[model samples]
Target: MKNFNIRSLMIFILFFSLKISAQNSYINQYKTIATELSQEFGIPTVVILSIAYMETGGGTSSACKVLNNHFGMTGRNNVNSSRFKNFTDSKASYRAFCEWVSKRKFYEKLKGSQDHNDWFVAIASSGYSTKPVEWKQKLNLVMKKIGL
Candidate 1:
């Protein structure tokens, strides 16, 4: 029993550490770009980062790796013949995301809102995705986890 407990504790610690690392890794990697875009485009930094984190699973998703599509965006795509735009890099993906936001009816509202949830709600209200309600919920959860 004692030996089993020790192994269990060790495994738990390892798993907890990896989870924390993945969480921080995503923020550390994209926080700069997200902040820059937020300042330039008026979108909330937290909203941008949370969306990327949720959509890409901290940049570990297969779509992110193979298609450079961190936002699950689908349009003008030529990368894999799946009708989704395959970006050349993470920066390109991020830029396209910003463009999509800028063109939405909610863009101005999002730009003016300081609340992360408001930003997310605006995105959903604008029909950003097919399942806006579920999408907003996920965004809210990610925003909460990220503390923004």
Candidate 2:
């Protein structure tokens, strides 16, 4: 029993380490684009990164893979449709996200703000997610996990 417990613990540790490593790699891959968007759009970098990470599942979501829609953004006149906005590339997707956010009414108020809570609240209130509360909760978890 003791040996089994030790092996299980080792396996768990290995899995956790791998998850963290993958997350770090994902962040590194997109951090530059996120940073640039934040600077240009006045959105917090952490907010942008956390939302992208959660929405795309670290860029593994079908929307990200197929549509290059990193933020789960739906196409115009297709909000109720399954179709998402297709981008030329991941950077284009990121830029589109920033453009969408910049148009939000709360953008001017929360612009350049580092407060994730406020940003999440504003975003959720803006109909960004069908399940706003749950979405914010998950975003919080992603932000925490990413150490942002």
lDDT tens per residue, model 2, 1-148: 9999999999999999999998998899999999998999889889999999999898889888877788988875222356688788899999988998889999999898888899999999898988889999999999988888
Clash number for every model? 0, 1
lDDT of each: 0.83, 0.89
Q: Which stretches of candidate 1 lie over 4 Å from their true place?
A: none
- Number of the top TM-score candidate: 1
Q: How accurate is candidate 2 locally (lDDT)?
A: 0.89
